[model samples]
Target: MALPTVPHLSQDGIAFSAVKNRPAYAIASVDSALLLASLLQQEGAMRVTDVAARLGVSVSTAHRLLGMLVYRDFAEQLPDRRYAAGPVLRRGPVQQASVARLREVALPHLRGLVEAVGETANVMVLAGPDVRFVATVESDQVLRVGDRTGRTLPAHLSSGGKAVLATLDDERLAAVVASLDAAVAVRLERELRTVRRRGVAVNDQETEAGLTAVGVAVPPSGGVTGAALSVAAPSARYSRDRLPVWKEALAEAAGGIARDLGDG
Candidate 1:
């Protein structure tokens, strides 16, 4: 999840190693409240006693952690006082806390792209063999693509995934594609080739039936990065002829973001 780094932040701005080691720190903390919160994060919603037992802390310490999390909107205590991820935290689409700065940098521009294109716009990053939506701008169309923020789906069926994948050389790209089954790999190859040739990728009913999406890569970083910007519309309203328009708008938006990231 730390694979997608911050955009518009210089290399000196963040220590990549710090982010890579976050999970380890999350596991090693001895602070009772933090320990309680950590356990809840790993094992899902739990009663205060359950969290306390797992962390080997007293109920009072568990309560302290729950209170802190609730105050920070990072955890929610149910009516029964069982705890789960809170609304604000549950809404966190970017798993890499360090890279969340990228979202802040990209929001204004991404919203502008969505407005210009008159279609939904999404930003995503790789999650294993799939792509996870990190941000979205919903379409004004009455019939539109749905929000996929924080949701992961197979890369083979997503225009965004292909767009990002196209930037990789054949060796690395093949390795990424090979993680999937043969059929999925074949489709990825076909789509990625089109993405490479056209500088845009389109998904025509490959994800959900009657839903079409077009995308371009967001080169947030050079060499082996996996971030994409996508536009989606209902298939009933899409046409091959419209692809050129979509490609133009998408390329403009992606190019600007890529430039900003490179300068960083």
Candidate 2:
């Protein structure tokens, strides 16, 4: 069976596209480093031998490249000798023009959401098992959730991340959940079920001690889903009583973003 392809927001925003042709003056080592990073991000984990074979380089060369990645926090060596995506890869932007376009298109909607809900709003995209905040619009209130752009949080813990996961097909969802610890996987599965049932996800301090957020998936365009829209506030100001209003605002913003993306 084919390995499940993790979606990233790119020009197409969903399906994996082949890397562009190698440049005429391309430095081999840099190219290899980039490809290796992409491999770890998409394929979960691999041994040095696997990396060598995949990159068609000698084992020593692969090892050297892996060392560089580890230094840069893009990959980490496992106790078993396999390497997996590390901090940078998990939080990195999509590195495509479409991500910029997506951010631009979503900003107005995000601003509108902040106006409606009177809290910070964010646009997030799934990156491997993590969610990267690509854009944020902060509330004008004296005390509010601050901007989180360029930050990453565990997908199983963040409201926007859970919302994105809820949009995944079963196979894709299983692939993601399998990467987590057994205990986390069990709990995440339960939360995801609730997300599916309610058409929204909530993070009541699951990611941070003082933050609470509500999110909805930006409906997939062309059968691809990787992004979500959320409204976040300080936990002190969060209440179940506010959920109905927040959910409605999030849904509207999500829909508007989806329509804009589809039309693009």
Which candidate gets the maximum TM-score versus the true structure? 2
The C-alpha TM-scores of every prediction are 0.62, 0.65
lDDT of model 1 at position 68: 82
Among the numbered candidates, top lDDT falls to 2
The residue-by-residue lDDT of candidate 1 on 1-264, one tens digit each, is: 232321112223321111112342343333455544433443357788876776667888777778888898778888886888776555433345323444545566678877887877887776556776666777665455554555556776788877878887778677787778898788678867777888988878776656688988887553325778888876777899889988888888877776766665
lDDT of 2 by residue, 1-264 (tens): 111222122222221111122243658799689777865764467899988987789999999999999999999999998998899877544533455567778999999998898888999888778886777887877556655655568888889899999888889899889999999899888989999999899988776556688999888763335889888887778999999999988998888888888888
Candidates' lDDT values, in order?
0.67, 0.77
Return the TM-score for candidate 2, rounded to 2 decimals.
0.65
* Backbone atom clashes (below 3 Å) for every candidate: 0, 0
- Kindly report which residue pairs in candidate 2 clash with one another: none
What CA root-mean-square deviation does each model show from the true structure?
14.6, 14.9
